[model samples]
Target: MTRKTKPSTAAAVQMPLKEAEAGKETNCDEDKPSDHPKERDNNVKDNDGTKPAAEWKLPRKKALLQFRCKLEDAIRGDYLLGRSYWSLSRLSRENMSSASSQPLPLMDIRLWGVPLLPSKGHEGTDYVLTKFLKARNYKVGEAFEMLQETLWWRRQHRVDETTGEAPLGPDELVLRTMYVRSVDREGRPLCYHVYGALEDREVYKRALGTKERVEEFKSWAVQFMERVARRLSFKDGGVDSVVQITDLKNMRSRSAKEARGVLRSTFLMVQDHYPELVHRHIILNVPLWYYTFHLLLLRLLHQSDKSKFILARPAKVTKTLLKFIDPEDLPVEYGGLLRENDEEFSNLDKVSEVFVGGNTTKSIRIPIAEAGSTVVWDLTVVGWDVSYKEEFMPEDEGSYRVTLNRSKKLRESVRNSYYINEPGELVITVRNPTFKKKRVLYRTKFKPTVPMYVFFKS
Candidate 1:
């Protein structure tokens, strides 16, 4: 067995999936995106927000042209007002509540940031409309109806005016349970839904307290989605969808009632309004009992959404998350080097890995020779159940060694900070006692700190 010293990537996990490397969105199977000269040219200004030409097959293209004409008629006839419409493609509209009690205009319509007037020649027009078309499987009538209903819903609810940071903001419970973290490997925003946070007695009480409170939570949830969506570019080939990570480890069985009653409606409403906006729905740390809950929930979803769902057992949480996100971009809690609001490391810092053979130990040495400097490091071992050691070894053998951790049997990612007064190296060791090889990923950073003596200078 060779000695494991320093950060070596000889044993890094070989990522086999290349889906994240794909450049174009997986459009409907009708036609492949054309490699048009204008689409390829970076200098083309008019098509900045438009999709590639010749993306639709002949029939779908015909249907799309007809759909555009229908949109023009809808704008002129003012049919996109005074009605509450749900996505009847899967679930019924009766389960949803009534439309808003406000008047609205049908003309000058827009979805997210793209104008809906097909005659306007805005490049984003076709791009935005194509999403609705795809959601309806290229059925012109259904897609147009969905578009009209979306516009009606937006105006009747006064979503533009009321869906600001206030008047319907998420409370402490919502903030704890759900949040927007970093981006995935494909640069899609990651929206984390940690239902485990609901186990907090206070959070539980607030989330399931009363019928009215639950309704408020639903409204707040919808607006939160809108806020995130509006920030996304409706432009062609831009990040238009978000990746949702739902963690179910700490959620209680009792809360399944809330999932059925409250979460079900909120989820359906989101699906209705936000068509094709979720690039992926990754559910992590799924417990055994949650399978029953998932089965029941599946009955209420559309086939499109059902296809997007990816479930991971608790044991595969870290591995599954890593498949779609690079280690540097993922969070520390999810077995990656990234730390939310981390001071020592950012997207700029790179993470490397080391491989340990079966029944062997690996030592990672990070040299920091500068005195009066603070070094921070984070690391984790895949399928970690091994003993680890951390110490500071002075460059000069005459100096004594400082032990950070004598030995630790780690199961999750870890981070620490240390200050150096002399030239030394931070050495971390992980022993793989098991019969299989192990992979270790780590990153480090250091910033000079003002020594006490320097501050005392007169």
Candidate 2:
């Protein structure tokens, strides 16, 4: 299901002369049917270009036959050309995968004697083209078009437009071709396309001076980069190809270029300004949470101003979270704060004071990474598990620890233990202990010293 926008006027377009020079001759009757067509009565020139109109006139049936033949031949040629699309794509993928540490093969990138913009000096171009396509495995617009057309055709036949009826059969979508275009950031025109996938977003955005579009692409790209950074831990791929569209003969003034340059710079400047948006693609059976650390990681990655950095840290999620800050580097006060708030240090039976009274009671204000499976806490104890607490003892002003003994009747079970940072997301999760054979078990719990709604009296 893809909806591709139309290409800009500047996108690459192959004119007849260029096509001819490339050995893509227009001599075939399928391409130049009028060149050799039996002349019409209106004094059209025949193949020999010497026939008079009266001699050239042919019956309508003959004209129809010639058109049919031409169409058939055209279809055959189109089929061969279309098939080459898949072959070229496969070749591209293979070459990218095998590209050495030396650099992308520049000579192989030329088209009809005109060389492609090199990726050597412009590192961003290589990263954008190779890595992005490698991740997606390029989509063929021809196939997409066929699917879209088929679906539309079926939809047209199955539904009663006036009555608002249901479709009679399974709906399908098809797409055939895509139009491509290239424009400079300043709206300077470059190339055009008849059949191709949507231009790479980063490349298009950078070239077109589309701030919003560039940000959208950067956000998506950053997430992808983060995933690759974490999982594959590969240093090879970064920003790839950069395609430029400009007036070839210096038709534009220096001011024009400068003006566009400002807009392009501003767009890149704000690329990482927003938090990442990660979401589950489908309904889920269990609770799940997503926390993005790309911004933090990027900052750390850039701090050194070096070309290479080795991540020797373990890959476990908890370990990764712990690696966020070097324990030794933490300030004494902040270290104490972390230790004080640390779940391991807090006693389960205590009402923990998470925030101090001040102008802002916003300590530990992390956004809710997950909204499913509401955490349940024992009112009498503050802990993840609270099955057997026998007694509660206060350790500090707003903290308590509980001793648990299931056999003792002196303790009371605590209920309503956990609170969610975000509401309205609990429906997606199963309650704790619902699926596991092991019964609910816990020793202690804790709560805030000053409940959020409570105002401190002077």
Candidate 3:
């Protein structure tokens, strides 16, 4: 008998010869002559040897297709047109071209004359651009135009330099009523506005009479925003958003009416230039009439903007304030742990004299006997409005420069303390531009130290 041929170990694990020859079956387990022992060991380790095949998770075909389609739609629709009512020509073509090739390019963002890009450190350009796009319904051209117009407005008004210059004489009222006092839990600057504190409405109205006054108001508003931005730009744990508290505790009908114009103008300016700056707004002690005004304001704001506003009555003011601010950082008057005797809150109302009436001017001159001394003043006004100007006229022929030029209205108070570098006369002037008579009260004292210590007893 002929010697029986034995099948090789590899042939037993492979497909039958007839099936392999016909190419109708593949033997995945069959070892090739070119395969190395190391490769085989890796395969065996991956499959655990006893198992015939390795486990694999295949993606769902339908789900993958759906995801791809949605992604394409997002890029072609939202990113390109921003749900705009009007269609753009080049953007449409670019969108069509991007569908077959690469991703769409974002529009160029510029401030003043410099181009800006979004990066890990700074997202300001992207932030401002997205706001404009949303405001214009994602029409790239219109959004760009809107952004350009705002930039031009800022440049024409020279908003960046407003902080260094003397505030318009009328803005003193705003300074007294609206101011940034402290920081919140997130380190964002906390701005406080006490609408109820306004004692006279007619004074504010008279102060806001001319176009120049209105422009000045806007400039000061922008300057405040710039100051906030500078704070945010600091490297030491700065925040980009601001927390605003508007207290309407004693707001009257006449005061509300007078404030409407100023409020409207400020709202529009904020919406246009400083987008995404206010992270939260707490409106405290809101009266029933305020809801009507709120509704009107809602018409001017985007839907996204509405969510940032929080309304609270006097009873719930503390609870609402505690949400975004720490008790330690909040002022004592606002139900926080900080004391009224703290440096930030102390002597805010330490006024000495009070005047009432209009169309009058007053001047006071104090001759400084010694150089390098300090002059401290506590001044306030009641009834109408007044303009304040101070100058240091040297004994010699040195030119006198205006140190303070601010206007005040209603019952706001101002405290000014400055040091004299040279021998000069401190000339103070207060003028009432309105026809109505207003009361003025002021007190001053000379100090022998570099930093004045008028309030402290030795």
Candidate 4:
């Protein structure tokens, strides 16, 4: 029921040495909202005076239809399905019937749970087929070949059967370094490839130490992808791809070189085996040479592959990510409100936004009239270069005001709590000293608790 295929690179690669995390993070996708942020002008030359490749766009209807028709014909004659190969997993040849034993006329053909037969009339069939076609630039011949190889690779490696931690035997930490964290603004799964985690020499060695280790990690990458795939809905108008946010801070050149074998092969596997599955590949905290490296990639990678990539240097890391992800879903490290193992808030908490214009001040007040209540708040001033402080203002002016935090400069998000014993308002003040506007995301909640006596019943 399975076959294996060895992948051959059809293009040059510039994979991150820390993880299988390249090729994601752009809002220019076909199904993205019309209000998607504007992309940088590709024609605009960088300081090196060289222009990057044209921005990727969905193929025209005529070309798409033409390629789809040709692909249908090829699939009809493929040996995998009654010589038509409407699928790689064909129905059993013997028909189960009480009257006669003629073979079943229908072949139950499918890929990733989506029926591949053009005749099957599955709503997602076109969407899935176009992915392969686009990966190969609308070349029916190449797309068909890629599909065949992808199915064989899945079968040979038993990819769909991949499960649990490090299925192919990579270090445990290797699995932790990359995985789905949450969904993006559009509901596509948001995955973080924290290459920074690999800076640990032991972790790096265990993952990319030898040829065998590299292959093991490659298998781990494939298995990791299967988990991400399970989260997707491969139907018309469904979220069928993932957004990759790769953090490359502290990645050493030596480590990168050591990881090149795994990185390159893993990148190639994603390209060949899971085309169009990456919605955006956002590279964060890139070093100085990232521009030059990316320029070379723009020239080498196919339009479909290169277009998903977005790079953000240390300073721009937050701003760049906020464009494609919502403030709530994005991790706090990237200037969003998200926190690991956070007990104070959930996605339903509803973060509110405010703007503090340059040389201006803004204030947020949360009224808590209930006595013996605790107030917890999470706040962030994007691109922070501001001074801020919070205070407990008592409704009874005679009771006096308490300064919770003294005014100070901040460069990151904030999470704090205060107990309120009386009716008053928790006031937060932000002063934007810079010459540019600052956007703030803030949320507050009230907590309930009981005396220790409540736990006494055994």
* lDDT string, candidate 3, 1-458, tens digits: 89998653233312232242244433322211121111111222110123211121223222222222332333334342344312333444454443433222333323421222222112233233434544554455555556556754664565543545555335377676677876665456787766654655565555455666656655666776665544442111124457777888877666566456666676677667766567677899888888888899989887656777899976667667867765545565665544444442322333243443467777777788787677776554443246777777788785566566554443345557778777878777778888866555555666677544655757
lDDT at residue 354 of model 2 (Cα atoms)? 32
Sort by TM-score, top down from the best: 1, 4, 3, 2
Task: Please give, for residues 172-233, the per-residue lDDT of candidate 1 as tens digits.
Answer: 66777667877776567788877777777777777767777776766667777777777665
List TM-scores for all candidates, in order. 0.79, 0.16, 0.46, 0.74
Model 4, residue 179: what's the lDDT?
Answer: 73
Instruction: Please provide, for model 2 over 339-404, each residue's C-alpha lDDT reduced to its tens digit, 9 standing for 90 to 100.
Output: 223443222133222312222211122222443323433222111121223322332445433333
Please say which candidate is ahead in TM-score: 2 or 4: 4
Higher-scoring candidate on TM-score, 1 or 2:
1
Candidate 2 wrong stretches, greater than 4 Å = 1-83, 86-320, 323-402, 405-458
Model 1 clash pairs?
Answer: none
**lDDT, residue 352, model 3:** 40
Better of 1 and 3 by TM-score: 1
Best candidate, lDDT-wise? 1
The Cα local distance difference test for each model comes to: 0.68, 0.24, 0.53, 0.67
**Clash pairs (backbone) in predicted model 4:** 3-156, 4-156, 24-280, 24-281, 25-280, 25-281, 76-84, 81-85
* lDDT tens digits, residue span 44-63, model 4: 21111222112223343334
Determine the C-alpha RMSD for candidate 3 after optimal superposition of all C-alphas.
23.0
- What is candidate 4's CA lDDT for residue 210? 83
